[model samples]
Target: MELHIVIEGKKDLGGQLYRQLSDSIRSGRLADGQQLPPSRLLAEQLGLSRKTVSNVYTRLTQERLVLGQVGKGSFVSAPAEAKPRRQLAINLASAAIVAKWDSMHTPLRAPFPEERSRYEFVGGCVTPALFPIDEWRRCMLHGLRQDVKGSGMYRQAEGIAELRAAIAHHAAFARGVVCTANNVVVTNGAQQALDLLGRVLLEPGCVVAVEEPGYPAARMLFASQGARVVGIGIDQEGMLVEQIPQGTRLIYTTPAHQFPLGMQMSVARREALLARALAIGAIIIEDDYDSEFRYDGRPTDSLQSMDRHGVVAFVGSFSKVMLPELRLGYAVLPEAILNAALTVKHLNDWHTATASQHALAKFIADGYLSRHIRRCGATYATRRERLQTLFADVLSPWFELVPASAGFHLAALCKKPLDLDLLLRLARRADVGLHPLSNFYASTPPRAGLFLGYGGIETLDIEIALLRVRDILLQME
Candidate 1:
């Protein structure tokens, strides 16, 4: 690799090179046993004499920072004590804003590979084994080939024409979402869709109602934009529409399946929410993140499909169903805010990646997306069933499973008062990762429970993991 060393005015090239090389070696930026660039090549690149570069290398060898071989080039030596460079503290002009950001909570963080347990029950993650890697690779190659014919200019802010149409058709067929190609705006993910909607629809101090014990990312996102985010409580139906303030400008709901606590919003509640949003002149963001994996009950119409007055903005993501790293999602916007949303999308990041859009468009058009969903859905269903059985038969003493008809995860409320934090700590010690229901709540008093996600872990693993959890509970008693 070429070394990045700057020589100023040719006054002290040796000193500059020596200091940078030593710092890099000590800091471990240059890993131990990594080959250094040829002295002649580095000298040419740095506009320095070969002799000067050799002298610097000789000095580095003397200091034992690099090892010089006769025929081979010098290599970085393992430092005695590799120390990370200390970060300099600087006062910022936007210190208050930075502090506010620091105070916000991030709830959607996934564990690193090293941090993953043998039985991880983390939500919003899909099993990689279920994805059709070969098919997806073909689509990606096709996308790359298609891009070779492009004009090499920035594409439309609304996204590529093919993807917009594909998403519109897919949403219509699968979820009964009412939309055309013109109504769609491809986004980086559902989070970006929410961010764009917040930018277009929200103002400082405006009231934004979100489901309490909700997706924290959405709540915090609206709050970050200076909106007064109010957490409306959820019951068996959904968010309490009656509790939403009259002056609310936006309402975020996961109607298909409530986040953390799994329950579909009843038709009565859905109608009430629509009426309330219409009356208050507010927009409703229906985040249908993972409703495709329905295990039971008939298919329900999306809130967007039921919308008559263009007050609902339907948001959906491929992250939950396919892979989160894809970062592909789209919004079926109302005519009122469609242009504004497109403008915001353009200003945000121009558009979602063209290659990804192309790949997903082909994935949908060629019927691979639906096939993949069905295949994964079956796997998830088996896992969900095993979890339900374990919760009902083996783990019923301390927990009661929430009645949920869809989604890959289920929430179970504690049957009796117990130290949930202690339970979680013990579970972690037993190599069973779990999520607390309390972490999802913002304003209202949180319920003591756990979210058991079946998407990442296998069906057999679910039985073993929860049995471990049962043992932990019994030991605690």
Candidate 2:
């Protein structure tokens, strides 16, 4: 049966509908799993339109107040009772969220690659399908059962000690970088690590050397911190260390699997970079973003392992290895910088989510993380091979594509300048998510080339996305 409650004016559109439905659920006017009236039916009761009712229901669903099953209907949720006591209804359509919008990577629209659907080539992604969700669920269940005791207390500022130890051990064994728990600081993501390091190290007008066409986030973080981010040109080998600006306090590079371009820095270049950093008294922020997924060659030794004068701060994350949503990353710091970073860490979000850190520790210690990386490297390589084969067999004869040497994507170097506005429009019309190379640069206006990411996509689906991509670009020709 349809539930009825009359709502008065325009003000009644939002909260009043929420109140009525919530009160119905809580007061037992609606029982658990009781299906809601269709939006059309609910609108008739309130003398309003369906959208207004749908909006309220949408907000309710977002708040965990009600659950919706598309083919069936919305149901009064038992969990809905938690939010009325825990969170307030917020109208975000009107309020501007004050995130210092980190223009660090490609300007990605929120909800970019919508919820693991087919035909989206969303870049810089890891598959949740491959995640240890069952293990995570078990850990959370166990945490709540025994360790949810600290209900209101803030988690440790240094992160979970066990997790920090696990991370330190993993680094020592996997990457050959030596670090103790004090040297490892868990962050929201690798971006947060960048932000935290930027905040502590960069001063107004300070110079930080960065690679041209580098990871956009590294460039953006240094720039946003009021640092003079000098873009040093890179070659097939790596960043030109000799070109590093004088008096620069830091140099940021993705030496292993350099973003978009996918070339690893050579040992000679690494030595020269370290030499230049030592000469200039500069620190190197090594963004080893996709170092784990090397398809072609041996993984380069990390700069941190080689630092004797403490010139490199290695920043890496499980977000790429795991899924991006987990918000797990770490920065290994030199002793001098460690205390300063910890202070900033305490001032910032205080700590990583305790349960996530704990869960990750358990995952790592039990060998799930390492196990996944091996599988991921093999899996992503297969998808990459298929995409590359499609490009080679089908598209590359006509289009100039840089065979993705490593990482999640392959880049198509356009013969002429691309009108990004029109390209994005075509991609949208075709329902594909790809990145533009220009979005990751320091200054020049956005230009040509598209990044075709294959991580979330299957090897089988690459042919279609590539075909559609070829069709879109061919229109310009």
Best by TM-score: 1
Top-lDDT candidate index: 1
Q: In each prediction, how many residue pairs overlap at the backbone (N, C-alpha, C within less than 3 A)?
A: 0, 2
Stretches of model 1 off by over 4 angstroms after superposition = 69-72
With a 3 Å backbone cut-off (N, CA, C), the pairs that clash in candidate 2 are 104-216, 104-217
Q: Write the per-residue lDDT of candidate 2 for residues 247-331, one digit (tens) a residue.
A: 9998899887777666778888998899999999888998877777777766668888878898889998887898888878999
Worst 10 residues of 1 by lDDT: 1-10
Can you write out model 1's per-residue Cα lDDT over 1-477, one digit (the tens) per residue?
556777788688889888988988999888999899998999999999999999999999998999988898799996879887889999989999889888877866766888778899988889998899998999998888878888889999999999999999989988999889999999999999999999999999999999998999999999989999999999999899999998999999999999979899989999999999999999999999999989888877899999999999999999988999999998999999999998899888998888888899999999999999999989888888888899899899999999888889999999999899999889988999988888898887889999888888987888888999999999999
Whole-model lDDT for model 1 versus the true structure?
0.91
TM-score of each: 0.96, 0.75
